[model samples]
Target: MLPSVVLMSALAVGALGANTTYTYTFPAGFNIGLVKSDELSSWCQGQRNECPSICKGSTKQNTCEPSTLKFNCVCADGSVPDVSPYIQTVPFYVCEATYGQCIDAHPNDAEGQRACKAAATCGSKNASAEDTTMSSTTTAASTTLAMATSTSASQTTSSVAAASATTNAAALFGLEGYSTGLMAGAMFFAARLFL
Candidate 1:
């Protein structure tokens, strides 16, 4: 019975530490209504192909269900991809791809062309705005750190230690999702023994 319990606990931890799925949605102002239902799957596939180019990882298991508006990418190795670059450019890429698709589907439809063009422009502007916002946030964080450094030595030291500890704890907990699973397993085993 003890061996079986231990095996279950280990299995639970393995399951918890498995692949993570990431969802990518069309940026705001993207007119999903403009895209035909049949075309969504193709668009998503294209986006999936674009993932490795944009993000810093492989995306072999990325998929998009037909008629769905989102793409799903699985992190097979339990390492979360750095999606900052992908996030910054996805809007523009999505818009451009939609526009290209629209053109391919209806070359002579002036109204469709205009709509697609407008959406593409909106996406471009959105990407630019996102870049600016991220820059501002980074600047603000740097300024805050500089300010903290100017505080009294003891207070600064304490604050830095607390911040470092919190960051380390969070990182450990987040890594491979193992810490959470281990804690839960330990609790389960303890409860079983008590019972």
Candidate 2:
């Protein structure tokens, strides 16, 4: 019984260890499929220390002590680089590497604020700035996730609404057309929210 218990504990630890420090593969067409926030996160955790990257103003990796799936994106290349489906980067965030060491930014920085910001040991930026390149990269990645989620939700809602047009459309018609006016309004509102 004692041996069994020890074996169980060790097994559990191994699984946990794998998760704590693991790698995620961005396969050839990973960007094509649905956003793999989970996989990306794992990779980021191991790579630059950011994962499940975000799409705010800039991408950021969580640099907090005890990090979750956090990471910063390094510009794979210049030009209209595709972070992933629908997620295009006008400008890419190069890894937060100026000389050699990572930017030891303070908590005040917008990009520096994210505890999970990774891939950057820290940069020369003295933590007074607003955002970092990693911030942009992570933001772009996160935006991709958000857009994917939004698109999925929209598709689902549209599909359901299409069937319920007779009733919902009638009810909403009293206020505003659910499919046209209402949805359009909602979409605009969502755009603002994201923007």
Candidate 3:
């Protein structure tokens, strides 16, 4: 029984250590507007212009090109502006704004207009529901198991696993690297306790 518990704890810790990457793609109709060079540049420039104000002491330059539209304001220190608040509110303002411009520019193009409209509505959809659900499920299970074990070691291990699961889930939306060192430290401590 002790060996099984150790094995299970080790496996949980291993699972938490796995590196995962998440990519967020614009909704179907939104891509059409985003693909236009002029619109893309306009959006990119808007984000670039806001970088200095958003990410103080960061190099304010056009970091985004037509091919890659990364909207985050990356600082010289390799940190990015915390846009999580805006994400909760505006979601993809760049896509929405550019799509509006695309629709205006192609007034007579019905398909393009429809696509822009569809893109505009994407902000209302809960795209991260699946990721959130998965994270929550994992956290709940880990917590339950930890409570059942009724040991500080098990509880710590479970908390780390839950945190890792949550962080991995958040990574899908491009919010990463914030708690990496902290998680590693916690994992090391938990492992020591287990041993």
Q: Which is the better candidate, 1 or 2, if ranked by lDDT?
A: 1
- Give the winner by TM-score: 1
Which residues of candidate 2, in runs, are more than 4 Å off?
1-131, 166-195
CA shift at 63, candidate 3, in angstroms?
0.6
Error of 1 at 31 (Å): 2.2
Q: Deviation in angstroms for 35 in model 1?
A: 0.9
List per-prediction Cα lDDT, in the order shown: 0.54, 0.36, 0.51
Give me candidate 1's TM-score against the actual structure: 0.32
Error of 3 at 128 (Å): 29
lDDT of 3 by residue, 11-108 (tens): 11232463222223443333443356775666566556555544444552325444445444444544444432232222255546557776877779
* TM-score ranking from best candidate downward: 1, 3, 2
The best candidate in terms of lDDT: 1
What are the RMSD figures for all models against the true structure? 29.2, 27.4, 30.4
Candidate 1: which stretches are off by over 4 Å?
1-25, 52-60, 82-93, 97-195
Candidate 3 global lDDT: 0.51
Q: In candidate 3, which residue pairs clash? A: none
Question: Can you rank all candidates by lDDT, best first?
Answer: 1, 3, 2
Q: Give the C-alpha lDDT of model 2.
A: 0.36
